[model samples]
Target: MNMPVLTSLRRRFAALAVLIASLPGAADAQADPAATFTALRAVDQRMATIAYRLTTANAPLCRGLVPVPGWAVHSLGQYDPAMRDQARTSFGFEAPIAVEAVVAGAPAARAGVVANDSILAVNGQPLRGAPGAKADSNARDAAQAVIARQPAAAALRVELVRGGARRTVAIAAPAGCPGSFEVLLGPGMDASADGSIVQIAVRFFERYTDDQVAVVVAHELAHNILRHRARLDAAKVSRGLLAEVGRNGRLFRQTETEADLLGMHLLRNAGYDPQLAVAFWRDHGGDVDGGLFRSRTHPSSKARAQAIADEIARIPAGSPRPYLPPLLATRDTPLQ
Candidate 1:
């Protein structure tokens, strides 16, 4: 009996060592601050691009989907001077909005807008000021403000420079949801949706590919679309910490399953392989709880992986519907 106990103890210690190594800090050494910020911003840019693509692609299939100008723009040097200099050199012009990407079949693409085109002005208002990061932000804000004020299918004039040649083109805006996304610089695999905004962690972004990131973003967006956050707050499930934890855990586990389903639809609509969702969750799900134990707040990694597989099978490839299942929440158990 004593010998058996000693062997079991040794195996348990080894397992703990593996688990400890996988934790955020132990797994990867601390990253340089500048490098981390740069990486986060890249994720921010990509998320903005993907979110716009997914929402716009599915707009016609879903109701109340408003489309904005279908283009991706970004500014540089928000935190560091080196980034700004890099942007100027990369684009060969110091413009406020750098057209990083244009969605195919979108208004901008139809207008022959190409990547590396530096946006000079919108609606005849010459965009010029400080080339600082704030100026870059202001430029984007002005563009969005202009878009917000326009009617659906309205034509807007955009002045841009390609290969140092100035040209003005007209782009018609589409209707899409007013929701947007941002990235948070932090450790750990965390994401959330609060009605209108989807926040993704940089650590998570660094760990996954764009397709994997899409699954997470789509899931969070699903939460917002289903109004889970507001419903949870309204339920007032519990005031005590332990009580809230138990109630929320149970509720979120259910919502997690639903998000996995809806996220697949979003991914399909956006032209990303829905199968990647299954791969991502399966590979990383086990890491969530370390070993065999699964939390109430989320289904077991095995269960989640299987759920994604099931969902993928249910939704036919190349035919996606922007339909979300009705989420009916009881008084105590919120859908989220």
Candidate 2:
């Protein structure tokens, strides 16, 4: 995507965060910094867990892959300046970045990398945090890029500070589907995947069970796995007012249908119940019929549930890992 378009999407993500802070009880949470941080971590941890399962389980089906350390990092600089001090105290952010959450039984957990360990460097290269936080990601992105460059099977040496003691650990970063999963702190019940990132609103965590939320995550991940954004860009599809009309609308709907179908397989591969896709759509689809989830560029909720149910019925019993659906063949084909 072009810089301008990417910037616009990022702005939307930031807006979601602001919207969350304005909701009921949000003010009270913000008043208590510790409570706010705790709640944020809970949401982030859930997203990390779900993303790890889906990405690692279906890595073979992805066109682009990256080493997943089974842990997520956060920078104190990413928080608002008003909350920076509290964040530093809460998370022990001794460096620019720190391990925010680690998936149990994953590479990072196996390596003894725990949450609150401040990451000083990766592979001997220092990571400097940005000053005057307005949610900058330079340090976080740089660290991830360095790790992604490592050999698929090699261990990643990380320098971190734990309990004020600096130590290094070698994490056997395993390959997984590309893109980072993030929780957008907001009340909006929305989710989206830009070619390189999958973001779900915090409301999903607040309202739905992890299994139901996983249904949405799998759908977004499928979009990235199929390169839907890039394909739409390649086809020169209009993303503005024209996006919901004519050929642009048809193409967008096609991608959504593809994601919905493949998403069922992804859910199954990740050991999640594919039936939740139908349940989730039936329960909350009407609530999201406006805004980004408008029917113009997406099929109706009833149609989506039926299609998912149909696809689930088609999958053979006891399908193997990384189930290859027929739709995978068209992922690389130029969009119409």
Please report, as a residue range, the 10-residue window in candidate 1 with the lowest summed lDDT: 1-10
Off by over 4 Å in 1: 1-49, 60-64, 80-87, 91-95, 103-106, 120-142, 161-166, 172-174, 183-187, 202-206, 237-244, 271-273, 287-296, 309-336
Clashing residue pairs for model 2 = none
lDDT of candidate 1?
A: 0.59
State in Å the error of residue 98, model 2. Answer: 0.7
What are the per-residue Cα lDDT tens digits for candidate 1 across 1-336? 000111111012123233233333333213333333233334445776777777776565344444467675654423234445544555444575667666666788899887678888877766554555332255555555555555555677889987778999998777765565655443345577776657665566557677778878877776666666676667554423443277666766666777676777778767888787787778886653443655456677778779878877765455435544333232125443
- Candidate-wise lDDT, in order: 0.59, 0.77
Top candidate by TM-score: 2
- The 10-residue segment with the lowest total lDDT in model 2: 1-10
